[model samples]
Target: MRIFDPHIHMTSRTTDDYGRMAAAGVRAVVEPAFWLGQPRTNPGSFTDYFDSLVGWEPFRAAQFGIRHFATIALNPKEANDPRCRPVLELIPRYLDKDSVVAVGEIGYDAMTPEEDEAFSVQLALAVEYELPALVHTPHRDKAQGVKRTLDVVRESGISSGRVVVDHLNEVTVGEVHDTGCWMGFSIYPDTKMSPPRMVEILRAHGLERVLVNSAADWGKSDPLLTRRTGEAMLEAGFSEDDVDRVLWRNPVEFYGQSGRLDLSETADTGPLFEGSSILRGGS
Candidate 1:
């Protein structure tokens, strides 16, 4: 029951969460650039954030023996802010870094014209950089959002197989099934698909290109939901190999398109990332 959480927000999580995830069999994760709950005022904020994604987060995950990779983008919510739009120019710098596996969390938030432009532009960047994409469909009007998402993906000229439309439920999974793109589901404690529900999706869809994640963030989410979902699959009579394909191999195949995923065991280093330590009082 090894797991690769294809979409999670570990930047907002605690060091304890990392230990728990590793114990739950989560060996790897991809954290996509997303909104900070509040609006970011300038591109400099994103610069620092992106730096930590490639730098500090990986160091922290390594302490728990988890390999952390990141995706870079100017997220949909902030794309509407004139001051933050400059972050677009800054993304290419991170995209070239080895740790960046994709360009992502880029898609419609409010579905404004501003979101439309940012989505199109970043999808173009993914094409140019030869990285995969992790797209976030709007939380509201999900069915319509997925339809529009597939439409924009079609126009971007990037291979559909390289894109993942995430945060989907039963209502929207079929929309992406035959599109040549991968489907993603976030198993949450509440307000999203639960373990039993996700098992049903896998049962119906047959786990060819499906990715299940915990998507834990700075909210009431659970980092172990990925593990819990795997348990549910077994209880529902899915073979161990079937569980492996959804939780592990599917994400490997999707993000592997980047040619940058390094699943090598991350060696634990001295307690410091740029003079900062995950320890207190030099423990």
Candidate 2:
């Protein structure tokens, strides 16, 4: 059961984490630039974060035989801090870099006006670059957040096929699916959706144009979540084809549209590293 975790924050993980992910059958991952556990105080931090996402992280994944790719964006939670504007301004310069597949993990959090502003700006960037957009909906007021995300997508005019609405649970899944955009589920440990409930969503949604990920970061989360979800699906009586479609095919089809997912032509060797950490060079 080869899989592709369409969402993850590999920057927060270790090389041994990558090895465990590969051993668990993860073939590739799409890591979106997001808020670190702590708030970044300067634009320089954000620049370094983006640099690592495209540089060392891919090198580390390669070492474990897992292909690495990323989506670049200004996370919603950080949008409120006026200090983040300069970093947001720098997004366009790197949006088209080799491993960047989308402008993403950008949407609403707490449904704040600042989040809306940042989301709108990044959504336009995705349209301008003709790349797919991965949206992160709110954990609170989820229904309204999902609706607001859809409205922005429609207004951005980036085709629905190019937008992925992530972090959906049962409450908002139907609405996200109804919007004609790709649906994403993050199977987390205590918060967000769990593996048992994920199987229930799969049972209801039927695995078409859907993706599953760990969204694993510095917080308490598991990098092998995709495998656990797959295991749950198997226990729930899903066929291998069903598992492949949701876990592998859908994400590949979505990110492959970015023209960066060509693992076939690239060498299978894992990415390079610095010490135990994946090192993305300083700008």
Candidate 3:
């Protein structure tokens, strides 16, 4: 079955990973601008990161026949740093880029006041641009964090339906779902949520406006997580139609709102990275 991994960090992965994903049925992915697994010392780092997301990464994915898209934001974990302001300033300039589909991977991290400020500001930006948002809730006090995310969305005056509350688990899924926002599940290897538990969650909650992703990045995570989830769904007695809606159709329908969903056309774009090796007849 064709699949779309709505969340992943291709910048931290290799072209080989992309090739394997394409071979496994993943046709598209959305990579959000997030903390680089370390503190970025300057705003220029953020600028370069955003540039790669809009430029190099998309070019790289096209070669593997995987459609690439992104969301731009100042992540919550970086909000506490005084140097983050300049990076935040750069976000507005690129939000309108053709490949940028949302205004997030932004929301509370430690539930700090600084996180609140960044979250509110980005929400306003989403409202001004009329773009959907991808919100990341905190790992601790998660239920409260999800509630706070919903509160901020309502206060920003953007429709709740336009927000996707991500990284949800059983402890927080009901609150996220009840908030009228779309729900996203990240099927990480050993930390976030396991594939087996994710299947149970889907069985209990029933797929309505739900999305599943790998959220893979510069970490010990699996890049082919969507496929793993699909395999699990099939084993759990879920029909192909049900699995398709969660893995493929839901993300397309969500990110399609940005006017940037074009995976169907990218399959003809050729290998993920051309002329980079002897395989492509390079010098």
Candidate 4:
């Protein structure tokens, strides 16, 4: 089935990952602006990073026949850094770009005041821009964070349907699913949801606004997890249409709220750098 990973960090992955994703039937992906491990010291750093997401990364994905889209935001983790907080002012400009389908990976990280400010401001920007949001629920103290997250979202006046509460699990899914927002599951190898576990959630949740993503990055993650989850769904007695809805259609419906989700390929596509090769030599 054709798949769309609604959240991934293609900035940290190689061209090979794109090729593999294309091979595995991943036709489109959304890479959210996230903390790049090292603390960024200034807003200019965010500018450059955002440029690459809209510029270089999409070009790279196109070479592999995969459409690339991005979500722009000052990630919650970086909001706590005093020097990095100025990037919040830079976000509005990126939000106006065509490929920016959402204001995302934005939510509580440490549940700090700084994170709260960034989350609120960005959510407001999403409202002003008429864009959807991809909210990243905190990994630690997650249950508490999820409640605080939904509370803030309620106060933001942004429609819950326009918000996607990501990185959800069994414990948190019930609450997040209760909200009108879309639910996101980040499948990983040893931690977070596994492919089988994702199928289990689909069994329990019934796959309405559910989104499954690999969330692969510099960590020990698998970029093919979306494909694996689809395969598992088929194994778990999910029909082809069921797999299609969760893996592909769900992301489309959520991000399509932007009125900016472009899956069509442009003229700017074909082989790798300097005309090297991702193709095999012999038939």
Give the Cα lDDT of each candidate: 0.88, 0.86, 0.86, 0.89
TM-score (all chains, Cα) for each model: 0.95, 0.92, 0.94, 0.94
Worst 10 residues of 1 by lDDT: 267-276
Model 1: CA > 4 A from native? 266-277
Give a tens-digit lDDT track for model 4, residues 1-283. Answer: 7888999999999877887787778888999999888888988999899999999888778777788999999899988999998888888888888999999889998899988998999999999999999999888999999999999999999999999998999999999888888999999999989999898888898899899999998899999999999999999899999998998889999999999998767222332233234344423
Best by lDDT: 4
Misplaced by over 4 Å in model 2 are 265-283
Can you list the residue pairs that collide in candidate 2? 59-271, 59-272, 62-270, 62-271, 63-270, 63-271
lDDT of 2 at 128: 89
Task: Single out the weakest 10-residue window by summed lDDT for candidate 3.
Answer: 269-278
Order of candidates by lDDT, top first? 4, 1, 3, 2
Tens digit per residue, CA lDDT, model 3, 215-273: 99999999888889988999999999998899988998898877766665755333343
Scored against the true structure, residue 153 in model 4 reaches a CA lDDT of 98
In the range 108-130, model 1's lDDT, one tens digit per residue, is 98899999999999999999999
TM-score-wise, the better of 2 and 3 is: 3
What are the root-mean-square deviations of the candidates from the true structure over C-alphas?
Answer: 3.4, 3.7, 2.4, 3.5
